[model samples]
Target chain A: MTASIRQMGVITAHLIRKVAFNPAVVWLIAMPLVIIYILGITMHGLFSAEFTPVKPYRIVVALPEEAGFLVERISRAPKHFAVEEARDAQEARQAVFQRQADAAIVAADGDEPLTVIAPPGSIVLEMLAGVVQASLEQEAQQVAAAQPPVENGSREESDTGARSAGAADGALSAMPWEGVGSFEYFSIGLIVMFMAFASHSAMVHCVQDRSTGAYLRIRALGVTRAVYLGAGITSGMLLGAGFSLVMAVITWTLFRVVWGNAAAWALMTIAGAASVASLSFLLTALLPSDPKGVENAGGTVYSLLAFFGGSTVPLTIMPRWFSEIFSWLPNRKMLDGYLKIVKGAGVKEIEQELFGLAAAALIMLGLAWLVVMLLKREEV
Target chain B: MATHAAVQEARGQAAGDPSIVVEGLRKSFGKNVAVDGLSFTVHPGEIFGLLGPNGAGKSTTLSIMAGLIRPDSGDVKIGGHSVIRETQRAQRLMGVVPQGLAVYEELTAAQNLDYFAKLRGIEKKRRRQEIEEILELVGLSGVAHRKVAQYSGGMKRRLNVGIGLLGRPRVLLLDEPTVGIDPQSRRHILDSVRRLAESGMAVVYTTHYMEEVEYLCSRLAIIDRGRVIAHGPIDEVRALAGDAVVLRLPFPRGVLDEAAKVESLQNTLPMPVEVTSGELRIVLPQGSRQAPAVIEELQRHGVPLDGMRLESPNLETVFLSLTGKALRDGKAAEEGAMA
Candidate 1:
């Protein structure tokens, strides 16, 4: 076991030298930082405009003339309330449907519960509902103070308060890139992107090793095939992780983009490295004789991955299905993790992305193992 | 020609049990048979040559003996360890210098040797000294720290050989280590290999260049179509061709193939006709007076000829006399198939 580990370590170090000494490594580090800077400086203005504080909420209330007191109280409320009276329930519903208002509130007699009408995922919906709920509760308090309580509500008051809080939490989490600057998003996004491209560079090394017979020579030294493969994967991870570090440091220095939570970033970086490195290892194993597929199509493949994963463009700007598709891509998961890390999310908060990346890496690793086995069948 | 005294010295050194023993090795890739029932043995301190063309299964045989691949049947034993069952144990006893330039171009020559030394489990304190010794031995001590990518072809080839010698294994397997390099580099490599054998290390040198084997190896095995057709002491193998003179003519591929296929020219000559990719070899009995007639017939057939040369009986002629095909015919077929 000691010998095996020594062999793996030596070979891994050997491969690392092969990658780190290549003059191309300089370009690997510089190109991504250049892109991140250009993309960050040029596009920050456009994205910052979207993240600016939203306008006042417009709520249309449908209630009887006797209930003018509730509407009057809501209009004077804080939290940027902009309430408009409706002729009837139809007009109130029409206001929300026509997008003229953020939400609508309908009511009947005093004992009847209020109904909220708002579009799904509307950022103002939760706050507006909270305002209307607070008004009703205040009115009920006044009535309760005047007379004896006849019956309790169907659901517990605790439950209603909890649901209101939970709804606010749900809406906030559902929104992507809140409190995230365009510079930070592009910083992490481009880093994650270039991290994957580093695998291609690593693949070129593997191809050279194979073409030049270095791999065969090492195998002849009583080293196991697994050790050689492990070395390739280990070196690949190092190369990719190194790029992200240098690029991250450059962006932080130049663009003032802070990558938060060292432990979280480390895990994501490792996971991203594993995801891409294992994937590159898989291609090398799969194409024993011909790595042309990877050599020829690697740029296009990574670009597609970046485009679909919201690295090239934000998923929020794309269709909703893009976000759904992002969940399946390891790159997208890495981008997600980086975004969350920049937002000060701890390891626990980004564990989902980590799990996703880990699973993808493992699957690629498993597939690579199977390919190595198949290659072993040739006994060469 | 090997001196009788040198052969006697080699014979004395080979008195003990052989260091490498390959028996009945057979392997096939799908429908193509790479090695078929091949057997050979090399004693310690002997520079044994496995002479063959590019596709004569020399590399595959060496690969199997080195435990890099498994033979379909039979096995190779290195220092008494079975290559098939005890592969790692067998492999540790041998150092392999592959046909290609296997040293890492991105690494310095010293770094390449150091990497292999560490991988071979050499002690850290001893590794640095050993690397320097190897670099000196391969004639690369002056540029030990320079990256191999900047190295000349010969320098790279020497590093390739240097890496194999780091572990000081009992046996060395060199698969065409001097295929394409300058005469200076080839001389250096051959001298290094000869010195390795003289130091009591058993060596198996595989190559199609018969002259290298003649100059370096004491004993040789001539293989064709994955089988050894001739093997013994160099003198005995050379004697197989008798006193026949070999005539070689170089031509374009198209002309060579047409010359090989011309039935009238073949039937009229009454001698074996062999065509390689762009060369032809014909063995003739001295005083037969068939050379002028053969050329005239070829001219009559309008077959283009680049030039012609007369050669003495060596492994090239012996191989043609035995297999009735040029060494490179098999090589070309194999390359075409691979392509």
Candidate 2:
């Protein structure tokens, strides 16, 4: 018993000396900080009006005096698009098809109204078609009612419809995070990546202990396997968890990202930190003798998770099949959980994600334990 | 005279039981047998050399005895505790310096000792003192705080020996401790082993170097092919080969063949005449009485001989006489197989 305690003490001290004092820690923290700052500057520039060009796109108008009401309404679009008159429907269609104009509006009176066309799905054509259709509808309604008496009565309903439509459009266009910046989401994931790398790199020494015969020498001292592995995982979790917390602080200060409720986010970070550490340990255990195998496997897994799990794109915009597949990955669950809390989602919203992260943590830890046992059994 | 007697009494009181005992201990890795029915006892206050060339099961035997790996069958008792039934007890009683230098090179000598000392269950108060004493014992006191990676090969070997002593174990097992070491470091390690034995610790030392065994071991075993071929006191084993007349002579090549052609000299010489590297070796079951006849025959053959001398057999001769091969040759072959 005394010998086992001594063995654990020695191993723990060795782990701390090597990992906590290693020069790589400096770069692990520094690289992420540099990336976060650069991304923050870049994102800010993209959103700033000084750097972005904003102007009403020009559209071609084609109509005769017989359709004066339609022409007038189309001309009245406020700052959304400017109207340019074409010689006829033929000229307007040519302009629209040739990409010389955003869209062409062709109006016909006393016949089926003609609208010059192009395929949908083009952002420019979609916006042009919306403007033209809205103008035509307003003109037709006004002519039929011959009145502006009900503006107050229907104003609230129209406003609500416009807001809902705007939200749906934003969800389709942006990466996840409820129309907030991608930097906020990417910064969090990058920070988590740093923690994972740092922890895995540090814990690789445990594998070295085996290859170098330090582990065998210590085992002869009668140390229990638990204390030895416990010290290792403990060291990894502390380093990974502490690094992630620092990243959260940096994210909040530099990017103005809302990390949601402080208490809830802290809880999620703790769970995520444990899961990342266990994953690293499990990966190190499963890999062959080479240390690079661990690095390759861990890197490949992290990259795949980040790319597919709505961390790179909004989940709602993903194809239906991909949503089903990526939803099973831990990264998606973790990001969703983090996003929910950051977006002020309540406990009810994040419970499933929290459980999923926990389950992942359990599976990884269980596999790590199994590997340690197999190694110990081989010693005997 | 009375004071000398009192010192002797005090020394005997400090001495412990035999540090190691093995009975019918056997082990194998898959189909290849490593240690086959090996049995030996190492008494306290002696450097017991388990000598072999290579693949002679020296390392496998040591591993089983040291509690690092379990024997496939049989019993290993360390300081009166059964290794299999009471592993912790066995471990606490013995410290093993493995075939490789297993200390973490990144850690300082003091830190390494303190770390292992804690694992050996030394109290915190005594741990620092033990580290200091061990460092001094190994002559590493001046550089205890320096990183081990920066240390010389000799310094690292000394620290490795020091690590094995941290527990103050009743028994110490050193597996090829001086392999690849400089002469100065090897001598220092031999001196340390002598000192440890003088202080009443039973040590099981394994090495392929025949001279190391001759210098330090009080009792020894010469193993071959996973079995002990010859084992006893150094002098007794040497005597087993009887008297060998070794003649260092600047003699012509093929002198032995030429000498053997003489009809009058053939029956009168020693058991056999062998030539190696310009030297003639004649092993006589009796003594060197046939030297004159051998000299005359060499002269008759027109073989110019210089620096003629005769000496009795040593361990090399004993090993050769018993196994019909040199100890070192066997070790070389084994190492080749391992490589």
| Candidate models: Cα lDDT each | 0.76, 0.68
Output candidate 1 Cα RMSD. Answer: 7.4
What does fnat come to for each candidate?
0.75, 0.51
* Candidate 2 TM-score versus the reference: 0.70
Choose the strongest candidate by TM-score: 1
Q: Can you write out model 1's per-residue Cα lDDT over A1-380, one digit (the tens) per residue?
A: 88889998887776777677777778877887788778777667435634322456787888766566667876785455678888877788778778798777665446644566665433455455455555555666777665412112321123112123123333445545655777888888888888877766676566666666776778878788777778778888988898888888988998898889999999999999999998888777777655466665567778888888888786544433447756779998898888888877999999999999999999989998898788768664
- Give lDDT tens digits, candidate 2, residues A161-271: 111111223333433344445566567656756767766765677777666556656766666557667666766777777777777787778778778787777777777
Q: What is candidate 2's CA lDDT for residue A115?
A: 55
DockQ of each: 0.50, 0.35
Instruction: Kindly report which residue stretches of model 2 are placed more than 4 angstroms away from their true locations once superposed.
Output: A1-10, A39-176, A250-262, A287-324, A345-349, A372-376, B1-17, B53-57, B224-226, B236-339
Q: Give the distance in Å from residue A364's predicted Cα in candidate 1 to where it truly belongs.
A: 1.4
For residues B227-251, write the lDDT of model 2, one tens digit per residue. Answer: 8878888887777877654443554
Best by lDDT: 1
